[model samples]
Target: MIKSCAVLGEQFVFRSLKEIMAKANEARSGDELARIAASSMKERMAAKQVLANLMLKEIREYPVLSPEQDDVSALIEEQVHEEIFKVIQNWTVADLREYVLEDQHEGADLLYIAKGLTSEMIAAVTKIMSNLDLIQAASKIEVKTTCQTTIGMKGVLASRAQPNHPSDNLAGMRASLYEALSYGIGDAVIGINPVIDTTENIYALLNETKSIIDEFQIPTQNCVLAHVTTQMRAIEKGASADLIFQSLAGTQAGNESFGISLSMLKEATALINEKGTAVGPHRWYFETGQGSELSAEAHYDIDQVTLEARCYGLARQFNPFLVNTVVGFIGPEYLYDSKQVTRAGLEDHFMGKMHGLPMGVDVCYTNHMNVDQNDMDNLSMLLGTAGVNFVIGVPMADDCMLNYQSLSYHDIATVRRILNQGPISIFKQWLEEYGIMENNRFTSKAGDPSIFMNGVLGGMK
Candidate 1:
C-alpha cells in the first residue's frame, strides 16, 4: 500500500504529459485542437481533485506527530493546492496544455510555486520526514508537560554544554567566526588582542597576526584589539581606559579580571591609533570569561549603556556611523546554568543600543563542564536567530574537526535518495551555486579567497 502511494506520487509529476501530447497531435484546426485540449484538461483537473482528496485523506489517518505521513501529506497538499490555484487564477487550460506539451515552458510556474512555500514550512516538513528512522532507532522518552514548561522557562545556562578542548574548539570556532564575518550572516563584532603577554618574542606574534589580518583585508571598522597588560600596571591601565568594557559571566581569574583591565587596553588603542596601522575607531573592549557577580553584571550593564550614551553624546553616535564591536565568551557553566541572567542582560542592552555594530561571541574555548551534541545544535540555532553574525565553525576549532567530505547531487534522483545525509550539505551546495557559500561552507575546500564584506560597511560609502 505504501509503495503504491509512493508510485502514485511520482506519477503525478508526469500525469499530464500524455494528454498534452495527444492534444498536440490531434488532427484538427488550431482553434478546435485548443478547445479539445481545454475540455480534456478540465477532465484531468477533476481527476487531480480526486487525487488530492485521496492524498489528504491518507494524510489525515496518520497521527499529527508522525513524520512520514505528515510530511508527505503536507507536501502533496501544498503542491496540489498551489498548482490548481495557478491553473484557475492565471493559465487557461490551453495555455497550460501547450506549456506541458512543449519540451520547455520556461519553468516560471514551478518557480512561482516554489517561492510560495515559507522557510518554516519547509523546515518543519523536513524535520518530520528526516527523523522517522531515528524515532525508531531510539526508544521514546516522555516528559510531562509541566517539566517541559519548566525547561523552557530556564535561561541560557540551562542549555546544553559544548565540546571539550579549548584549543581545538577555538580553531573550529575561528572558522565559523571567519565564515560569519565574510558572509554578513548575523550581528557580529570581531575583537583582536593586539598585545601578547610576554615581551620576549611578542613582536613576531603581533606581526604575524597583523599580516594575517592584512591578507584577509576585512573592513577595519569590524575589528578591534585589546592592549597588553602587566601584573602591576594592569590595574591602573585597566582603570584608566576611556572606553566601556564587558565580559562573560564566571571564569575570570587573578590578573585576568574584566572591568579593571582597561588601562592596558587604553594604551594599546592609543598606540594603534597613533601608528595608523591598527583597525580602530575603538570605543569598547569586551572582557571574555569573567565570573559573574551581581555587582559585576550590574556594573557591566551600566558601563555598556554609558558608553553607548557617550558615543552618542560625542557626535550623533546613536546614528549609524559609530563603529563598535562587543566580544563575548560562552562556556559550559554559562550554557548549563538554570538562570542565564548575565546573557539576557547583555543581550537586552546591546541588542537595542548598539544599532549598527556587529556583535558576536567566541565559543572556541573549552568549559570545565559537559555538553551534548544536541546542546551544540540548539546553541547554533539559537545564535543564528539571535542576530549573531558569525559563529566559529566546528571544523576550524582546534578540538572538534570536520571530515572535509563532499557529496554531489547531480539530479533529482540523487536528492530523492538522500537518507541520513543531512540537508545542511545540500543547502550549502545550493548556496555555492549562487556564490553565497562563504558563510555556509561545510567543507574546508569550500572557502572563498575573497574577504567577506558586510553590506553595512559598504553602505558607509
Candidate 2:
C-alpha cells in the first residue's frame, strides 16, 4: 500500500511539472521560455535549499531532537510549523539559483534571513541593520513600544525640565506622571540645561538634572526644556494697561496700580527675545497675576499681546521655525470662561494674527480643567488643518479604568451604526459588504475559514 501511494504521488508531481512546462512551451517566444525556466528553476532550488538548511540547522541547534532519539521524529513532525517558518527565512530565490547553478557559496541568504525570527532575534537583526547606531533605533522603538503599551489610558502627563538659570547649581526636573484610581508613578529626573537661564542657581539645577536623566534614562519622546524667566519678562514688558486701557491711565493709584511697569515689560521683552529663541520646540506656558478689577475683555486684550510677544520672540529667534507657546490663565476667574472658548476662536484670535510663524506653533489656552475628548478631537482637527509637524499633549495611561459612558470604543461603534442608518452609511455598508473592516480584525484562531481562503486566494471583492 505504501509503495502504491509513493508511486501515485510521484505521478502527480510529474504531471504537474509536465503541465507547467507544456504551458511555457506554448507561449512560443524565446523570452517567455527563458522567463518560465528561470522561475521554475528558482522555485525548485529555493524549496530544496530551504528544506536542507532547516534540517541541518535544527539538528545542530537541537542535537537531542535527532531521529536516533526515541520519539524525536514525532516531536520534529509536531514542530513542523516552526520548521517551515525557519526554512522560509533563508530560502531566497537568488540563493537557490546560485546553489543550483553550482556557483561559489555566498552568505547573502544569512544576511537577509530575519522575517521568521522571534522578537528578540528581530531586535538583534535590527541592531545589526542600524550599523551600530543602535541607540537611535532603540529610541524610536522605545517610543513606539511605549505608545502602544500605554494606549487608552488617561491623565498621563509628561514634561521636560530645564535649569532656572544656566549657571545655577540646582538641577531641573523633567517629569511625567501616569495616574490611575489606585496607583500612580511619577517618572522624574534632573537634566542639564542646553541653554543658560538668567540665574546661576537655575544653571546648576540643569547640570544636576542632566545627571539624573543620564542615571535613570526614562524612555519618552515628548519633553520640554523651558526658560521661565524669559517668558515672565515678556509678559511684564509687552503690554501695559496704561498704554491700552484709559481707566488706569493716570499715575495709577490704589488697587489700579496693578498695571504692568515699563521696566518690568522691558526686562520681560529682553528675556523673551533672548530665551524664546534659545529654547527649542517647547510648550511654554506663561502664568500671570492680574488684579480682579480687569474685565474679561480687558484681560484678554492685554493677554493677547503677551501671547503675541512670546510667539514673535520665538519666531524672531528661530527665524523660520515655529515654537509652541501656551498662555496659562492661572486664577480661578481667568479660567471661568474657558469652557466657552472654542479651539476655532483661539486659532482665529492668536495663530491667524501671527505671520511667518512656523506652522507648528500652537497657543494652548489651558485653564485648570483636565483635557477631555472634545478638547483632544478639536486640537487634533486643528493640528491636522495647520499642517503642524509635531504636537505635545498628554497621552492616555493604560491602567485608567473608564466608565462605559466615557469609553471611546462605544463612540466608534455608534459612529458605525449611524453610518449604517444614513444615506452616507452606504460607504460604511460597502466596507462591510466588501469585508474590509471584518478582514482587518479577522483571526484564524476564531475559526474564520474565510480568513485562510482570503489569504491564500485573493480576498472576495
Candidate 3:
C-alpha cells in the first residue's frame, strides 16, 4: 500500500510512495525508462508517477542542462514523455508565467496555459515558495466578486446547489433547492446539470430556479451547466441562465473535448452580455481540475496546476464571477490519494486566488480512492480559514447522480460555524426564519417546523 500523508494506519493501502520514488530514481538508461514506462502502463506497478517526480525534481534543483545532460534526461524524454519534456525542459516559474501572458503577436495562443500537463512542476515551483508569497500573489491579482447579500462589496464566499436531474423535474429540483436553502447555502448561486438534453431541459431547470429565487426573494441567481452555445440558445429563447458554467483546460484539445475554446468563451461572454440578467456584469462560473488536460490528451506536456492557473487567466479575460477547482474529483490516477489531494487542493486554491479569481474548493474524493471523511473535513476547515469563496453542498457530499462525494451541506455548516462565518445576509435570514440557524450557528434539531420549512416541504409529497 502506498502511504500518503492524509491516509495513515491500517486504512491506507498504497504502501510507501517514498520507497517507490527511491526505486524509480534507479532507472539510468533509455532501456530502463522504456521498461518502467511499459511496466507502469501494463499494471506491473503504480509507480508511474516516479517518472514525473524525477523530472520535476531535476528541473527544480538544476538549471537548464546543456546538450551533454545526464542519460536520465534522454530516458525521461523517450516517446511518451517527449511532449512534456519539451514544454518544461528548460523553463522556470517566471518563464512559464511569461509564456502564459505573452500576447498573440508575441506567440501567445488564444488559450494561455501555464499548468496541468505535469503535477511535479507545480509541486516543485510551489515547494520553493512560502505562504507569504502565495498570499501576496492572491492579493495582487485583485478580482472582485459580488453577490446580493454583500452587494457593492468584494471578498464574499457563496454556496452553490449543484443538482443534476433527469430532464426538468420540478418536485425533485424543489426538494434540492429547499435542502440547500434550509442549510443556508446557495446565496452565491443555485445551478444544476441537466442529464442529457440542453436547451429545453436547461430552460426548465432555470425557470424552476428562478421561481425559487423569486418566491424567497433570495439574493441569488440561477445557472444551468450546459455548454455555452446551448446556454446561449436557451437565453435567446428567453430562458433565465443567469450564470454560464463550463469546465476549462489549458490545451486546445481539452477545451475542444469540452466543446469550448478561447473564441467560444469570448463569444459566450459577449452573448451573455447581450442577454443581460439581474446577475450583473460578472457572470461566468467555471470548474477547473488538475489532470483534465492529461485526461483529454490536451496538456501538451505541461503541469496541471499551472495549466489550471492558465485556465484562470483565460477566465479572468472575461471577468468571471466564480471558478472552482474540483481538486480531488478526478480520482487517484492523477492525485493518487488524499496526501496528493490535500496538497493539490491548497495549491489550486492558492493559484486561483493568486490570479484574482473567486475560488471555491470542492474538497471531495471518489469512492475508489484511499480518501476518508477525515481528509475532506480537514481540507474543508483549512480552505474555509483561507477564505475560499464557497464549497459544494450536496447531501453528505454524495452526489448520487455524479457518483462522487464532495463537500456536504453539513460540512459547509460545520466550517462556517467554527469560523464564525455565516452565509450571505439574505440567505442567513431565511435560515433564521426556518429555525435552522441562529446567530450564525447551525441550530441542528432546535429548528422546529417553522412556516418556512412547512412551505418548502408542503410540495414534497
Candidate 4:
C-alpha cells in the first residue's frame, strides 16, 4: 500500500509505512546506508506529515513484520493490553506525541499508555520528536526496577562499574571497581565485558565480583557480559551470578545472529530466578544499540530507530533490571559522528523509558568515531537531566578491554553533584558508612579506593 501526503503543494508518496518511518527519522548514516532514508528534506517532511496523521490502529495493523513471521512481533502483539488499546486506537500519532508532552500525563500515565502501544507506534512518535522534545517528555516518566537494590528512583542517577580488563585479570578489574566504589558509583551493578566469552572465564569473573560484594558487604549486583547461553552454562556450574546478561535485537533473525531466542531468554530468566543471588526478582541485564539489526543483515528494510524500539519491546517482557543502549559503540558507519551519537542516545533513553523499562545508556564511542570526551560529557548531562536510570562507569572514561570511551567514575560523581542527584539510597547509606559522602556530596576521602581495603575510614577506625 502507498501513503501520500502533500507539503507546500508538493506531493510525495511513500511506498509503505516502513519507508515512511525511515524517511521521518533524523539524518542517520545507517538509514542512508540501508538506502531507506528520504532523498530530500522536502520528502522527509512529507513522510513526517503522513506519519503524524497516522492512526494508532493503522500502525498496529500494518506491523513492519507480521506476528506469524517474527516472534518478536508476536511477543509485542501478545503484550498489548487489548482493553487499553481499544480506548486510544483512534488517536493520531500527532495526538500521541502531544499527550506525552502534555503536563498532565506523567510517568504513571505514560506507563499506562505504554501498555496500549506497540513498538512501531512508539517509534512513530519518536521520529517526530526533536531532541529537546525527547528530553522534556522523557523527564516526566520514571521507571524503577530492583534486583539486589532498587534503582531509577526520582532524583537518583545510578552507574554500572564496568571493571573490564584486557585479559579477564581479576586484580586489574578489582582496582577499577575500587575506584568506582570510592567515588560512590556502581550502585546499579558491577558488570564486566569479558575479553574471552567462554563459560570458564565468565564463571571466574562472576565469582570474583560476587566475592568482592560479599567481602565488602556492598549493596550491589554482579554480572558478566557474555552470551546468555554461556552465562547460563556458568550458572549451572556454580558461578554465583547476581544477574544474567545478554545483548538483544529487535528481530528474530537479528537475535539468531546473536545466538539467542525467545525460548533461550525464557530459560535464562527462570534459571536466574531460581539460582541467582539477587532478591525480589528483576535479575536480567540486557544491552541494545541502533544498527545492530542492519549490521546483521536482518533489518527487513525498517529504520534503525524502530528496530531499536523493538529491542525494548522484547526486554520489557522479562522485567529486566537494566537495559542500556551502547549509543555510539556501533561507530561511524551507523551513528557517523557526535551529533548522530547524541541524537541516538537521547532517542534510546526516551524510547526505553516509554516502554516502562529501567533504562540507561553507555555514553561511549569507538576510537575511530569523530567523537571525544566532550561529546560524552554533553550526552551524559542530558541523560542525567532526563532521569536516566544509570550510565556506565569505566576507569578514566576508557575501557581497556572493550577499547571504547565511556563515562568515568569521576565524571559520574561530577554529574551527580551538578544535577543534585545521588546513587541508590542503600548504596548512599553504605557510602556514608565509609565516609565517602556527606550530605549528598562527596567528602575529602571520596576518591581514595584504599578506604575499602581497611573496612573503615580514619574517623571511624
Candidate 5:
C-alpha cells in the first residue's frame, strides 16, 4: 500500500498482508521469496521464506483476491482470532507437538498466550505445544542451540550495565557508570568487575556505587563482579550488593576456574536471601560465551555452542537476573573469526533465552579477531529482532580494560530505534525527564563530536 505510518494502521496492515501473500506465492525458493518481497518492500531477510510459505499455504485455497468484502478490518481480526481459537480448540498438545516436529520448526505458537489468546482459548489450549518443545523451537529459529531464557523481566525490554576498569578503581567505575547513563542505560543493574579482590575494595566499591545512584537520584542498583565467595564476604561486611555475577561452564574443571558449583551457587543465593532485604527480591548475573569451554579445556570434545548452552542451564537453576553471551568478547582462539563469532552470538542468545533466563548479548569483538563494526552491526540487528533480552553499551564499543570492542551506546540506540523500543520502560521516562532523551528517544550528537561542534562554531571566540 502507501508508504506512511499507515503500514502500522490496521487497514493498511491488512492491505500489505494481501500484497505480501500475492508476491510470496509467485516466488519459489527462499531466495525468490526474499527477492520478490524486496522488489516492493526493502530487503526481506531469508527468514521470510518460513513466513511466506505459511502465508502461501493458508492463501492457496482462496484463489480469489477479492477486495469487495465489507469491513475488512473486522474480517481480518475475526479470521486471525478464529484461526488462533481453532488451533487451541482443534489440536491437542500432542497434535501441536507433532505438527512442530513434522514441520521441524515454528514454535511461535508458544507466544500465543502473549499474542492475545483469551482465557477461554487458554483453557482449551491445554496442549498448544509442550513447554519443553516450545522452548527448544524458540531457540533454534536462528541459532543452532537447545535451551531457553527468561525473555521479559521487570516488565521491560531487559537491559544491563557492564563497566570494567583496569584498576577497578572508584573514579573509573564512576566514569563508566556516568557514561552509560549519558546514553540512557540505568534500568537493569550496574555491575563492575573488581580487579582487586580485597573485601575493603569490594565494600568500598559497593558503597560508592550506591552513592552514584543517590547522586544521580535514580532508582537503580549496583553489583561487584567478584568471586561469589568474595561478594559474600563483602555482603557480610554490610555492602549493598544487588547482584551476584558469575561465569560458568558445563564441565567440572571449567566451572572450577570461576570457583562456582551448583551447590555453591545455591548456597550463595540462599545466603543473600537470609541476610537482609537490602537487595530487593533477587538477582543473579551470568556470563557465557562459545569459546570459554574450549578455552578451559573442559569441552570434553563437545562443541562450544552446546557447552555454552549447558552453561545457560546451569545459570537458570539460580533464577538468573541476567544471562548474557558475550558473543565475540573471548577472542580468536576459539571462535576463529567474525563469521563464526557472529553465529555463536546468535546461538548463545537463543540458548539463554530458551531456558527462561533474562537474556542479553554482549555484542562484541576482540581486536585480534578478523572483525569490525559491520560484524557487530549485523549481529546486533539479529539479536534485536530475535528479542534477545539486551546488550552491553560501552563507550566506542571499546572496553579499554577488558581489551575488547563491545556494543557502543550508539549501537544500542540504533537497535532500539530500529525495533521501535525504548530502554527499560521506566528509565525511558526518566531519561526524557532529565533531557538525556527527548520524546522517548535518545538525543545526542550521534556521529562525530566535530559535527556537534559545527553548530556552535559561530559562537566560539
Candidate 6:
C-alpha cells in the first residue's frame, strides 16, 4: 500500500491506513489526547496528500478494522454493492472528492455512488475537504424516511421536541411540550431524555406523551430515550411508542460498552415493528457522536471522524427514521471549542447523508465545553442550510435532565423562518388548524403555551 508521500520536499511516512486517517483529520482534542494526531501542521498536510492519492480499492482492501474482528465492519462489508464498487475501484480519494463536488452531480448521483463506498472511503475524502465543502455537498443530498410521517424533504425542516425533566415530573414535561407544540416543533418526534432509565419510567413517559398526541390529534411520533433493552421491555408492556431510541458507536467493543449488539438492535427492531404504534417500515432513532469509541477505549487507533462514519455504516443497515449526531455533547475533550465542534458537526452531517441515512443533528454543548449558545446557533443555522432532516429542541435551549444546552424551540422556529422552510406537511396542517402557524409562518398564537390550557387544543382542559 502507498503509505508515504512528500510535501514541500519533506517526506512523510505513515504506518497504516489507521495512522494516516488519524493524522489527516483536522486537529481535535481527542486525537491529541489519544496521541494519534499529527505532530505538526505540515505532517497533517502530508498525511492528507498521501490519503488523497490512494485508490479506493486499496483503501477498501485495507480495512481499518478487519471484518474478522468486528461485526460492524463485517456488516459494512456485506452492504457495499460489489458491482458499484468495481466501477469506481480505481478512483483516488481526490478523484472521489472532485466527483462529488462536480457541478452536474446531484443528490441521487451521490446516493448511487454511496452504495459502492465504504465508510473509510467516505472519511478519507472528508479529511481533505474544507468546511464549506462539507456543507455544499451535504446540502445537495435529501434523505427521507417514514415513521408516523416522512421527514427530510428538500424544502422541509423537522424538529424533535425534547421536553426533558430532571425528576421525571409529568406536569413539567407536558408544560415544556406544550411550549414546543405551540411553536410548531416536534414534527420529527416528541422525544425526551428521561432522568430515569427504568422500563416503568420510560413506559410512563411514552404513555403520557402519547396521550397528549392522541388528545390533540398531533401528527408526529413519541419516544423516550433510554437503554435499548429498557425501551424494548416498555414496548412489550404496551407503550404506544412510534420510535425506539438508542445511542450508537462505531466498533463492536464500543457498542458493547453502550450495552448494545447488532443482534440486540435487530431484536428491538423486530419487537417494535410487531408491537409498536407507527405505520412504517422504519422505526429506529439513533444518536452518534465523535470520540465515543475513543471514550470507550475501542477506537482501534482510528480517527473519530472515521469511527463516526462507521456508526452511520451500521445505521444504514437499519433504515432508521432518524439518525442524529450529538456533535458537541461529549465535551471539550473531543471537540475543544466552537471551531472544532462546528467542523465535526458539518463532517458528521455530510458523512451521514453520504451513507444515505436520514440524518439530523443535535447541535449541542455541555457546560464544561468552551462553547456557548452562539456556537450552537452557528451550527444549527449551518446544519439547517445544509438541509438537515431535523434537529433537537429543548425549552429555552436548556435541558434539565441532560444538563446540556441544545437549540431551543425558539431557535428551531427562527431557523425555519430564516431558511424559508416548514415542518413535515401533516404537522404543518395540524399547526395551522390550531392557529399556531399559517402560510408557513408562526401566528400570533404561537409561543403561548397557555393556548393549550385555555381549552383551545381540542378541549384538553
Query: lDDT score of model 1?
Result: 0.28
Q: List TM-scores for all candidates, in order.
A: 0.34, 0.28, 0.70, 0.98, 0.65, 0.98
- Candidate 1 Cα outliers beyond 4 Å, as residue runs: 1-196, 215-227, 230-268, 276-280, 288-357, 363-367, 393-444, 447-461
Decide which is better by TM-score, 4 or 5: 4
Candidates' lDDT values, in order?
0.28, 0.26, 0.59, 0.92, 0.55, 0.93
Model 3 lDDT at residue 209: 87
After the best TM-score superposition of candidate 3, give how far the Cα of residue 384 lies from its true spot, in angstroms: 1.0
For TM-score, candidate 3 versus 6, the one ahead is 6
* Span of ten consecutive residues with least summed lDDT in model 1: 143-152
Global CA lDDT computed for model 3: 0.59
Give the Å error, residue 94, model 6. Answer: 0.5
> How many clashing pairs per prediction, in order?
37, 31, 21, 0, 14, 0
Q: For candidate 4, list the clashing residue pairs, or say none.
A: none
> Per-residue lDDT for 1-461 in model 4, tens only?
33998888889988788989999999999999999999889999999989999999999988999999999999999999999999999999999999999998888999898899999999999999999999998998988888999998999999999989999898888888988999998899999999998989999999999999988789999999999989999999999998998999999999999999999999998999999988857899999999999999999999999999999999999999999999999889899999999999999999999999999999999999999999999999999988899999999998888888999999999999999999999999988887888888888999898876666775664
lDDT of 3 by residue, 51-150 (tens): 2334432543432212143221222223123454556666554444444333431211311232222333433344334444433333233344653333
lDDT of 2 by residue, 405-460 (tens): 11121222222233231111222233344343343231222222233233321244
Ranking by lDDT: 6, 4, 3, 5, 1, 2
Residue 253 local lDDT, model 5? 64
Worst lDDT run of 10 residues, candidate 3, spans 105-114
Give the distance in Å from residue 151's predicted Cα in candidate 6 to where it truly belongs: 0.6
The local distance difference test score of model 5 is: 0.55
Question: Higher-TM-score candidate among 1 and 3?
Answer: 3
Superposed Cα deviation of residue 137, candidate 5 (Å): 5.9
Give candidate 6 regions above 4 Å deviation.
457-461
